[model samples]
Every structure is written in C-alpha cells, then in structure tokens.
Target: MVDIRPDWQLLIDGGKKDSDGDGQRAVVNPATGEEVATVQEGTAADVDHAVEAARNAFEEWSDTSSEERARRLYAIADRIDDHFDELAEIATLENGKPKNQSGNDVFTAVETFRYYAGATDKFYGDVVENSKDELKLKVFEPYGVVGVVIPWNWPPMHTADFISVALATGNTVVLKPAPQTPMSSIRMVELMLDVLPDGAVNVVPGGVEPGVALTNHEDVDMVAFTGHDVTGEAVMKSAAENINPVMLELGGKNAAIVFDDADLEKAVSGAILNAFYNSGQSCASIERLLLHEDIFDDFLAAFLPAIEELNVGEGMDPNSQVGPIIDEAQYDKIQSAIDGAVDGGAEIAAKAESPTDEHLAGGHWVPPTVLTNVDPSMPIMNEEVFGPVLSVTSFRNDDDAVEIANDVEYGLTGGIWTSNLERAHRVAARLETGMVGVNRPSFVSLGLPFGGYKRSGIGRKRDLTETMREYVRVKSIQIDHTDARYSLDLDLAEQRTY
Candidate 1:
C-alpha cells in the first residue's frame, strides 16, 4: 500500500490543513484493489469553516491588480509543469488511468491554467448607447465565493480547469475532490497554495456530506459541479433556496456517426479511441456507434481487431492502453448492464482479453466490450455504462442516423465521420449536442467551449469571454451629466401607466 502524506490533504482557510472529529477514508488503487493511502475526510462543519475563510479572503483577493493576478496564476501553472511527471504517476496509481492517458490529463491541467492566465486581462464588459442625458455602461464582477465539486475521472485536470477559471475571475473557492481519487487532487490544491494567496482556494476531501454542505452554504455566491446527473440535480435544487447560480457539466451518452463516404481508416482509429480510452470512463466517449449500412460490416472488420490489440492491465505498464474500472461497485454495475442486455437478446460481438496474471485477478478489469443486435430501447444502449463497452447500430441514411443519435436523453457530445464538407456541416448542425467533431473526436481544450444539451449538463467550460461569462456577474452603472434631481424633466401624470 502507498503511504500517506500529511501535508497533502483536507485544507481549509488557505494552506491550513484542518480536520474535525471526522475520520479518514481509504484511497484505493483500482488496478490492484488495494489501499493506496488514507485521506482526511472533511465534514459538513469543515465546509462551514472553509466557506467562512473564503468569504474573509474574497474581498482582498478580488481587489488585487489584474497584472499581479496573472502573474500568480502563471506561477501556479509553472508549478504544475514542474510536478507534471509526479502528478501523472499519482493520478494513475489512484484512478486506474493508463500511463499515457494520465499524462494527458496532467498536461491539460497545465494548459488550462496557462490558458486562463493569459486571459486574465482579456475579459471585457459592454458599453450601452443611450440618449445624451446620461452615461450607461456594464461591468463584470466575480461571485465572491464559488463552491466547486469535481469528479473522480480526470481529477487533476478537472481540478485545474475549474479552480483556475474561478480564481482568474477573482472568485475565492472551496473545492471538494471525489472520494475515489482525493490524494492527487489535494496535492494539487497544495501546489496552488504555494502561488495563490491563502484562502483563495481551499479543498475538502470527502463523500456526499461535504459536497452537500458546500453547495447549500448561504455564503457561496455560486456553485460549479461536474459529475452524474442525479447528484447535479440535488446540487441545483439545494442551491436554489439561496438562488445562487450553478454551472453543471454532467454525464453524456454521446454518439459517433459513420457515414458511407467516411475515410474508413481514420473513422476506425477515432472510434477505437473513443470506445476504449480511460477504459471508456469518459463522459465524452462515443457510447453509441451509429454506422452507415453500407459500411457497417467493413467498419467492424477493422474496429474489432483494434479492440483486441489494446492492453488491459495495470495502469503503470508502459504498453497498457486500458485500465480497470474505478471500483468494485462500478465494475459490478457495468457487468450487470451487459448481462441484462445479453439476456434481453443483445449479442456480445467482440471483447478484449485482460491480463491473466494472478496479481491482476483482484483488479476490477472491464475488457473492451462491443455489443451487436442491440435495440435502441435496451438499458445498455440508452443509459450510460461508462465502461469500456460499445454498442453498434446501423443506420440506412442521414436522417435515420441523426434520429438514432438524438434518441438518447444525453446530448453532451457527438461526432460525424464523413469527408464531404457540406454534409459534415449540415449533419453537424442537425445533431443535438453542445459540441461535435467532424471526421474525428473533439478534444476538450482551452479554445472550444465544452458542455451539453438536455440532461447532459448545464453550462460550458472554456476561456471564451462566454465561458468566462458565467463565472462573473454583471452590474450596470449610469451617470447623469446634469447634477439635478430630474423632477422637472418628467411629469408624474404623463409618465404614469395606468
């Protein structure tokens, strides 16, 4: 078992590591089904202290100059770069991400921080055109304290993305990491404290209690969350009592549509990546593969072999391309979904093999699985399996493909595999999703805004003045050139609307 580092968890009021009578929880390694370390769990009371700390620090931190803030944010990015290798390893061991994918998450964290840092001085409000008597303008201001809740998948990257945007927009934060993967996330908050001011960012590591406390806190001006839809619903409902805003990026049952004219090689490659990356634990993965009838057999001929070649084993293996499911419960859930589908007549078209080593026997391994003869109404097809599982369905034409793609409740993201530019644009426009990738999968980055439609999610995550828009509140100011009460300019009887 990996040892615990006392300095790396349960921080409140800036860099102070504080805990109440609540005990620690075991952090598990999904690859071996063993305890990696124990992290202090922050209780509801800890959230109160963190919120208070953030409130006390908000004004001073928000008042800092933009240039200085940029410098400090850049410093945090530099620190992430310095620890990139270490963070990658830590995340892999804890979260069961393949080595390469873990590194990608960390690298994206660096990019996220730098992206928002460069954008510090770039956010702008608007000037209103009005009559000559008065000057009217709008300005953006930060929500004093933001409550952030992130998921277990891609912990470091999600932590970096959410917190950087909040701090960049001059908001103080109270962050809560998922119970499944808290070590690296708390370590990340520790690194940020080295550069950011005390209390500017605080982290509480725990299960549901801390998250509920943070979201329901009256002092938190806004709440940002990324997770499953059920939890997001609770968060939104709780925060509504105070009428504070919420930014929710929830789950997805994304689709990948392959047209008849698609480049088979490229389509197959992207489909493979989408179906199996991070053991298909990504919300943006192609949960459903809709293929043109003309290319259905041809695509599977190439796609099935690729799935078999992917290595499913320990995360640290240099050759490993797939990792275990996050835990036993999730493992069983995915298995049940597959079993139920098969019992309901869905056939297992192909499945990859996991490492046969006895040490890996304890791991919650989910081989890359593909299901054929699946009905759109099947639970596996409609619900989010969130495992290395793919279901294939054939479409006769464009309209059928779009209908099948849009059939699910989730519209987080989808892709079109076609070489024709016009068809790509036309179909992409028709698809129901927040983002689409033509001929390839879209990468979540600093440039493109990320979110979903319908039950998928609530808001976008990007550095656009628009993604930056949600982090801030707008206030309008009016200045009258004449310093008069203006009672003479208006007649009460004429102005009255009976």
Candidate 2:
C-alpha cells in the first residue's frame, strides 16, 4: 500500500499561503483502492480571506490590457503543459478516471485556456453608432470577483476551462472544488501560482461549509457552476438574496432519438458511448433513449450485446471500457435508481452484477446497466440518473420522437439520429433544449454556448464572447448634445416644432 499521509496540499491564496489544519479529507485512489493523501479543508473564514485577496488582485488585473491578459493566459497554459503528466497522475489518483482520459482531459483543459487566451486579444466591445458632438461609449469591464463551484465528475476539465475564461475576461476568482475531488484542483492552483498575478486566482477545497460560504460571500460578484440540477437550484436560491448573476451548466435527463431511416450501427455506437462514458456521470449523458417503433427491435439487437460485452475494470487498465463509479454514495444512488425503475415495472435489459474479484470488490464499481419497456412518465426517465444506466422507450414516428424528447423538464441537451438532413434539423429544432446533436451523440464544443432552458439550468458557458458579457454589466452613457440641439417637449409651454 502506498503511504498517503504527506504534507501535500495547501490553500492557494493569490500565490501564497499554505493554510493546513487538522480539518482534512482523505484522497482516495479509485483504481488501486487506497487513500492517497489527507488534504486540508478550508473554512468560511478562509473563504473571506481568499475573496479579499481576489478582490484586491482584481484592481490591477482588471486594468490590464486585453493583450497583456492574453499573454498571461498563454503563459499559464504553458505552465500547465509542463506539468501535464504530474497533473494527470493526480487526476487519475483522485478522480479514478483512466490515465489516458485524465491526460486527454488535461490537454483539453489547457487548449481551452489557450483558446480564451488568444480570444482575449481579438474580441472586445464594438463602437455603437451614437449622435455627434459628444462621444457616447460602451465598455466591457470585469466584475470584481467571481466564485466558481467546480463539480467532481470531470474536475480538471470543468474547473480549468472556467478559470481560463474567467481570468481571460479580467475577473479574479475564488474557486471551491467539490469535496470528493480536491487534490487535482489544488495541484491546478499550484500551477496557476507560477504564472498568475498574486491573488488573481484562489482555491479553497472542502465540503458544503466552504462551498456555501464561498457562494454567499459578500465580495463574490458572480457565480459559475457545473453540477446537478438540485444543487444548481440551491445556488440560484442563494444568489437570489443578492441578485448575483450566475452561469449554470446543470443536469440533464437527455434522450437520443433514433429514427427508422437512421443507420442502426451508427446510432447504436453513439448511444452506447454517450450513455456510459465517464461512468455515465456526464451531465449530457443520454439516459433516456427514444427509439422508432419500426427499428426498435433492430436497435436493441445491436445495442444489448455491445453493452453486455463492455469490459468493466479499473480505470487505469487500458483495456477497461467501463470504470468504477466515483464513490460509494454515487454507487448507492445508481443502485437506488435502478431499483426504482425495476419497481416501476421497467424491464431490466442487462443489470450490473457485483464483482467477485478481491481487487474490484472494495472500490465503487458497477457494470453497465440497461433497462427497456420504460414509460416516459416514469421517475427514472424523468429524473437525471448520473450513472452507468440507460433507460429506453419506443416512439412511432418523427412526431412521437419529438413529443418524447421534449417530455422531460430538464432540457440541457438531446440527440437525433437520422440520415435525412431535413428531418434531423426539423426534429432538433423542435426539442426545447439549449443544445442538440443530429447523427452525433456528443455536442460539447469549445466555442458554442452551453446551458439549459428549464429546470436544468439558466445562463450558459463556453461562448467566450457571450461569457464575457455575463461577467460585465452595461453602463449607458447619454450625451447632453441632443438636449441642447432640441429643447424638451414634455410640457406644452416648452414644446418646440423644428
């Protein structure tokens, strides 16, 4: 067993401060099934300190030119590249994702930063046409400080991407990583300190106390969060007290509609990958699959065996197709959801069996599961199940597919599979969602805006141009030249006809 107790983590305030204390949480390695380290947990007071540091730093950071901001961002991206291997190891150890997946996610996160870095110099507010004599202007300026609540499923990608965009837009940040996965995020903060200006970025990792404190901090100007709908709601409720602007990428009970004209093999492959990737913990994972009645049997024929043959093992194993769930709590949730579906009269197509092997038995591992004969109204279909479970239902035609697709209250994303281009557009347009994919399972993009419509979430992320807008408030500057040129006509005595 690897020794885990080490003086490893510290609260990153600006560029300094190792606020270690007795309050610590164990960092578990899901692959090897061991506790890697006991990281220090931050308190509400700590959040105050971090926010103060960021607020102070914003004074200088906000004044920086777009070019200078871009340069600093690129430098930070370079630092991330230098430490990619070490970061990936930390991510794999802490998050239990495959080593390759961890590495790729890190790479993607760096690329996201690099993209924003380049964008900072290129994009700025345009000059709107205003009346002559006096100059009327609009400027985009940074919010004082931003609070980011990072989720656990893809910690590095989500946190890094948000941090990059937040800083590029000239906003300082006080970030709180999820309690379950904080080491990877802390290491990211360590890397940031090497390049970022002092107090430009701060990280405090802990449980609900710190998160709640960070969100409700008086100094925090805006909130950017990625997580489940339930927690998203809580964040919004908290923000309402202050009327804080928020960008939320929340949960989804996404559906993948397969039309009869679609290629069965392609649709089946897309569904399997999207529904089960990241242990089905992805926000955009297609949990409810709506199949056309004509091709329903054929679709199941190919999909069932593919799921059954998926190799379930440790995330680090190169051959492992399905990895362990994040933790015990998530495992229990997955089990409960499956049981709930079964009780609702849904047929289990393939249930995940517990492992007998000693190595796999201790970790939170679950096999890929599938359920059919699902009703659209079932709780399992209605709710977001962030696990390796797929619930499928059948539709008669295109109209039926749209009805079933839009049936869910959560509308973050959905997919349509069809060879016909016209039908794909029509169906995709009909789905009341923030994003939808046709003939594709995944719609995550680095340039497009990502968010939900209804209970899933409000606001968006990743539209560098649009995201910058969220971080700024428009100030209207009215010229008095119009008043001089034309007298006020509010009263009959002051009225003038020109």
List the RMSD of every prediction in angstroms. Answer: 2.4, 2.5
Candidate 1 accuracy as TM-score:
0.96
Tens-digit lDDT track of model 1 for 183-221:
778878888886776788899888988999999999999
Candidate 1 Cα misplacement greater than 4 A, ranges:
1-8, 130-132, 488-498
lDDT per residue (tens digit) for residues 284-344 in model 2 = 8889898888988999988898888887767667776767888888889988998998998
lDDT of each: 0.87, 0.81
The total of clashing pairs for model 2 equals 1
Looking at model 1, residue 182 earns an lDDT score of: 88
Runs off by more than 4 Å, candidate 2: 1-5, 16-21, 351-356, 479-498
Question: Cα deviation of 449 in candidate 1 (Å)?
Answer: 0.6
- Given candidate 2, what's the lDDT at residue 164? 86
Model 1: pairs clashing at backbone N, Cα or C within 3 Å: 14-199
